[model samples]
Target chain A: MWSGWADIMDPHSLTKLNQCRRERRAAILLTDLGDGSDRVIVEGDAVDGALGDAVANAFRSGKSGTREVDGRAFFLNVHLPPPRLVMIGAVHISQALAPMAAIAGFDLQIIDPRTAFASPERFPNVRLDAEWPEDVLAREPLDAYCALAALTHDPKIDDPALTAALKADCFYIGALGSRKTHARRVERLTAAEISSASIGRIRAPIGLAIGAASPAEIAVAVLAEIIEALRSRGVGAERGKAA
Target chain B: MSQTMQSAPPKDPLTIAEEWLKDGKEVAIATVIETWGSAPRPIGSHLVINKDGLFEGSVSGGCVEGAVVTEAADVIADGKPRLLEFGVADETAWEVGLSCGGRIKVYVERLG
Candidate 1:
């Protein structure tokens, strides 16, 4: 089967696939359609294609699956950027969180307006955005690939970051704080018009309750909780249930 | 002049294939189209091979790389795409130490 010849994927589809990769847009590649055919479909445009629904669904799960279109089977390969963890504070916890997240196959970035907290000296080799959460989030925006965490205990910083994350519909929204502090934060967010359902989405006291004592332990807890939310879709969708 | 250092990001499979083609390498790309059971790698994982046996990336973790490379050599020469399959039934799995290895379906195609 390896010695026959033909370029089944048209140049037009090939160009679209390349463009999607360059833009970091999710795309589904459908190949091996019996006639040695291949087609790369980008999101939003897939539904118009022959295997549109399969492409759209595979895009969400980020995995490859086979579908039988008529008697012939086709494989849909989903491709998207690596998952990203956007840290809202450059705290001691974040210092530990960044490298661990990278090791877990997540692209990590620290966002803080305070220059002292976000300096390159402190966060060497990490993506540091030295702008207020609201401003930076507004400019760059967040997508499904992102997991946003607010590590700063300060309301002035963490609250706005959570608010932005909710709007972006981040898969995971974690806030580092005590239960008492989260209650106060909730009150403020309620006052700011963030819905109860949205507030519930925040993984308060962030991280799994592993009886963490120090910043490093807390970082471990946080990363663990984030993974739970990521791997367990039900856990991540807890906010939707609040409605 | 002191130059600043920046960390380069990982390139996607298409970009790697394009680069290989640009470098005047005769390339055939093997992509994991479908998998059953414990697929160590996700779908869309790619292995690009040149006529000279040089390869980049992987389709399966390691179970069928040698077979894919040998097939890819024919693909590069014949210009015909082949859909290849490897499973636990294949003796290569025992050699690769994959425990009752899963079935992996890869599509090997020539990319110009």
Candidate 2:
């Protein structure tokens, strides 16, 4: 039953796993408890049987645990990239979000065309890009691991980044605006050729409806929402209870 | 390029292990494959050991590391993997202070 266990740890496998991690790719390091041999299975790599199901589950759950398959135990160590929070405006809410997001383990970045608001004095120790979101995002493309918050009320600054985030399949895309404002913005995006379905993914009024009236409290709501979106990814609609 | 914050500010054990391998040092990687009760570290926790007994990471709350490191040297020399189990019930574990009423299985193997 334990014939599948291979003792040698493949050097190339470790190298490949590290490369996958550095590239922000999801992977699983599967170690056979029978013979102590292991290999790294990337997210899209195909596998069959109970182990395949286990791998898929691990990827979705982002969990590490031992599994028994055909009387052989295997340890699946899941590695998902750290989540990123990209804010379109380095404004008051972002100023509050910058530190809170960092403490919450989100790599936060703020981009705004206005240098006055995006200055070091405002967002110290934060990754502040004093440039248009389109220009900054063109170089640093968004991906599934990223959560983009379009805080700039200006459509000129927010719309292009929202389109990019939607196109890149960002895990969470939120825009700061009221329901009425979002309706108008939706019309503009539709005029700009963005599909309604894609536009619908944006969370307008961008927060967990916690009655957050202040900038800092609103920042809390947005960060909580982003966390919810991240933790619930691929897990269906199992959302956390709102505070 | 956009100044997006990429936070890997501190090097983790696996990254250090890769670096040690690249630097041509003989290394062994010990992982916590299983844990029960109040094991301080969770499963998949890594403790990497180099030839000179220098190590990074942790498998327990400062317990059983010395033994794991000693065992790691043998793994590095022989290129054979080893599975080590420790529990509070064990005499050595009681002596070494894994007395947190927990158990853990560590798989140690040479990393090329």
Candidate 3:
């Protein structure tokens, strides 16, 4: 019921930004406060000067703010893909984790080959994949935005996903096992030709040293650990913030 | 995965704005450009409105949406953008101030 305005934001830019969001790609909407002009900058886009530095920082921190660049004010509205929690097993710990992770804004998914464990009745309202990690992850690969947790305690089911997560450099990679169990896992993974440095990234004895006994308690510990990884991402040495 | 990510909610203000524009409706987007102290909403939050007063999303908890909606009408009528401030310092605090005592600067402009 109206003619378009001459100075309105280009509809093309809005659509592009939304497309980036749907693609789980990072984007920044840069708007000049003085002129009300705007454009969308996808991650890895080459932007120059102080503004470019600001844009890069926003992409890393996922924080939105107004920056003063070259005497002009620009608002950088950043949209990073939501973090994904991909559980390698639909065990009891995952049952507790599924709901808790959702409350914390994670896109939680459970992948298990055993239909008996990944049944809809067990994981209602969660993304349950009653398929092998190899097949599911092949279709939807892991990314730095994803956190992979191997919980089945079975080498056949957990080892392959752990290998994939490490290869993909997932922000958080965890495997559930005792120290002895993890040692054997390390040996097997080492024999598989995965570099020790890459294998070292896996959080074994998974979760924090919270002395968690119950599955729900362990879920809390694991979620906290994932948050720690997510927050301290990109800064290699600052991971000592939490025990 | 990029190929399989679900769509954004139908009620998301920006999505609604794009849909409304595609439907040939006049739309205005209000964005919180800055916030101070205990602002209810963070910077970059959006509130979108159509010329018919239909709106979605919120720039504030619920305190200043009415004023933003009113200003959006003017933005839709004219192509000029509007920068609005609401806080304890403004003289119109009694009328449209944020009850949380925080300050926010919102930029509203028409969407083509």
Docking class of 3: acceptable
List per-prediction Cα lDDT, in the order shown.
Answer: 0.77, 0.88, 0.88
Q: Write one digit per residue (lDDT tens) for candidate 2, span A39-76.
A: 88998787888998899788877889999998988888
Candidate DockQ scores, in order: 0.28, 0.52, 0.40
TM-score of chain B of each: 0.82, 0.91, 0.88
RMSD to native for every prediction?
Answer: 5.9, 4.3, 5.4
Task: Point out where model 1 deviates above 4 Å.
Answer: A1-7, A41-61, A65-72, A233-243, B1-6, B16-28, B34-43, B48-80, B85-105, B110-112
Considering DockQ, which of the candidate structures 1 and 2 is the better prediction for this target?
2
Q: Which of 2 and 3 is the better model by DockQ?
A: 2
State the lDDT at A212 in candidate 3.
98
Q: B6 in model 3: Cα distance from truth in Å?
A: 10
* Model 2 TM-score, 2 decimals: 0.87
Docking class of 1: acceptable
Estimated TM-score for each candidate: 0.71, 0.87, 0.82
lDDT of 2 by residue, B21-48 (tens): 8999988999998899999998889999
Fnat of every candidate, listed in order:
0.35, 0.69, 0.59
Those runs of model 2 whose alpha carbons end farther than 4 Å from true positions after fitting are A1-5, A236-243, B1-8, B99-102
